[model samples]
Target: MSWLQLKIDTTKAQAPVLEELLETLGAAAVLMEDSADQPLLEPPPGATPLWDATRVIGIFTVDSEMDAIIEFLEAQLGEQLPAHRVEVLEDKDWVRAWMDHYHPMRFGDRLWVVPSWTPPPQPDAVNLLLDPGLAFGTGTHPTTALCMEWLDSLDLQGKTVIDYGCGSGILAVAALLLGAKEAWCVDNDPQALTATRNNAEHNGVGERVHVFMPDDMPDMQADVIVANILAGPLAMLAPVMAAHSHASTHIALSGIIRPQVDELREVYGEWFDMDGLAIKEDWCRLSGTRRA
Candidate 1:
């Protein structure tokens, strides 16, 4: 079955209305993206921020009435339609097409993030079977990769790990596969917690992995802690992270850019003996050990 993809360029303020209108007009799916190369910074908690210049695309069946939909949209907005175009999308195995672009990506020497459909290039390596999903973290982003690499370097055997802001539970699962005895995965989003649990089960570490929301996280110090979230949250959560660490407990923080390093270091440095910064592209990762 072919699809009709209608693309409309508009401001972020108007994108939502357009999206809802298209959905009401029998659109199967809607996707909104940055029309301009604008950098979106960390949004406030529970906010789904969009770029100033947005491009909203609505997908409908090939037989859908494009003219009627446009007329309705224009009528609703009380003005002429914005810059827009329609294209025919040929049907194919989209999952396979997406999977083809992602092969096994090695983080450090032994840690590899492989898609579930593909076999690991090196069977001896500690392979993490993950795919792109509703939640984040597949070792593709620089922040996630840095955390995974740090995990790979550690001798996690018999140690307890805490993956705060755990998305997809990649870090916790990696720690377990790297020989950690147990892992605690925490996230604010329910979907993230669900994804974490599912990923842990898929990686054969469900029995050893625990998932929780921030408010409900139990009081337990971990041997190692990793938080791959934005710099702002990392700074704010320093006290919480410190509470979950004891003397000499290893910690790694990422999702930071270059300019935000000093402030975060100052915040976390109050409890952790800061280590050298790791940089990949424009992203940065910070690691340290907790002080007594």
Candidate 2:
């Protein structure tokens, strides 16, 4: 089937209204993206943030009356429609298209993050079978990749790992696949916890993988603790992270940009002997051992 894609460039204030209007006009789906390459800071819990310049896209059946929809939208706004375009979008297997581009990615020499649909390039290497879903961390982003590479370098055999902000449970599951005794995944989002659990099970390490929310996380020390979250939250959770660490525990923290390195170093240094600063593109990963 063919569809009509309506793309509109508008202010953040107008984006939500446009989405609602498009839905009212029988759009099958609506998506909003940043028109400008703006960096988005973490929003307060339960808040949704949008960029100053937003591009709103609406998908509708090709046979829909686009002219009537546009007229109604403009009449509702009491102004002419902003810069927009409508194009025919031929139907394609979007999932297959995505999988075609997302090939198996190797982190370090031995660890491979492979899509569930694809075969591992190195069958003997540590392979993490994953599919990008509702949660993040399929080992594609620089931040996640940096953390995965660091995990690859470690001797995780018989170790207990804690993955704070565990999106999709990639790090925790990878640790298990690499011979870790157990992995505990903690995230604030319920969806993330679900994704983590599902991914862990998909890799056949379900019994060894535990999922928890931040508030419900148990008070237990781990041999290794890895957190891939924004610098701000990383800083704020320093005490919580420290509470879960004992002397000589290895810790890896990513989701930091180059500019935020010094502050994070200072914050995490109090609990751990922070040292290794790995840079990938504009992102940085910090690693250290827990202080006595």
Candidate 3:
């Protein structure tokens, strides 16, 4: 299907207004990119809070109703956004174009990212199938990999786990296969639940992995809580996730860049003791036990 790519040009001061407005319009994916900087998993290193001009590109799937949606959004944001700057294109080849650039990535001692189209290697390594599609959290991404690496090193023998925002269910499935007794996964997206279920089955842990939609989260707690999601949501969900964590429970978090660590840490610090944090490339992951 074609998509309305709303490319908004704005000063640093106006970016947040545009961002908030776009979300109000229900943008499927809104990515703000620097005029000169390349795409990144996280904000660039030493990147100031809002230092430069940028193109806030918002992608919305276009259908028969999409024209109206675009018109409505244009009218809603036109005064604040440059309407002429919008670009309309058929995004059929977008993900395929990215597939070439992301063949397969290996993380730590175990965990190999084998795309759905490729056969998993028979390495002693843990095989993770990732076809992130649109919901994010592919095991190949640096942030996700960092979390998987931490899971690989943990002593998960017979432990219970909760994987919030469990895109593709890679972490929870890995925990079960790696020695955890069982796991529960929470995601608001039905597509992610399907993807997570499929990935768990592919890894031979489907039955043991419990999937939960946002409103239907299980009240049960666990020995560990893992979420590979953006820093904003991670901080907001810390209390709910930490409720499932005991004093000895390990909490693992990802999808945060280097700069956002302090803010995120401060949020989770109320319950979790941030003893060790890991960074790879522009992404970072934090791991710690709950404070007794």
Highest TM-score model number:
1
Question: What is the clash count for each candidate, in the order shown?
Answer: 0, 0, 0
TM-score: the better of candidates 2 and 3: 2
Q: Evaluate residue 28 in candidate 2 and report its C-alpha lDDT on the 0 to 100 scale.
A: 74
TM match of model 1 to true structure? 0.72
Provide the global lDDT of candidate 2 against the true structure.
Answer: 0.85
Looking at model 1, report the run of 10 residues with the lowest lDDT sum.
37-46
**Native-to-model Cα distance after best TM-score fit, residue 189 in candidate 2, in Å:** 0.5
lDDT of candidate 3 over 57-136, digit per residue (tens): 66666642545655775677565235325566565633453466566666666667777666667556677666544344
Clashes of 1: 0
Residue 167, candidate 1: how far off, in angstroms?
A: 1.0
Better of 1 and 3 by TM-score: 1
Candidate 3 has its poorest 10 consecutive residues by lDDT at 40-49
lDDT of 1 by residue, 29-64 (tens): 776657653222223223445667888888888999
Q: What value of lDDT does candidate 3 attain over all alpha carbons? A: 0.73
TM-score of each: 0.72, 0.71, 0.63
- TM-score between candidate 3 and the true structure: 0.63
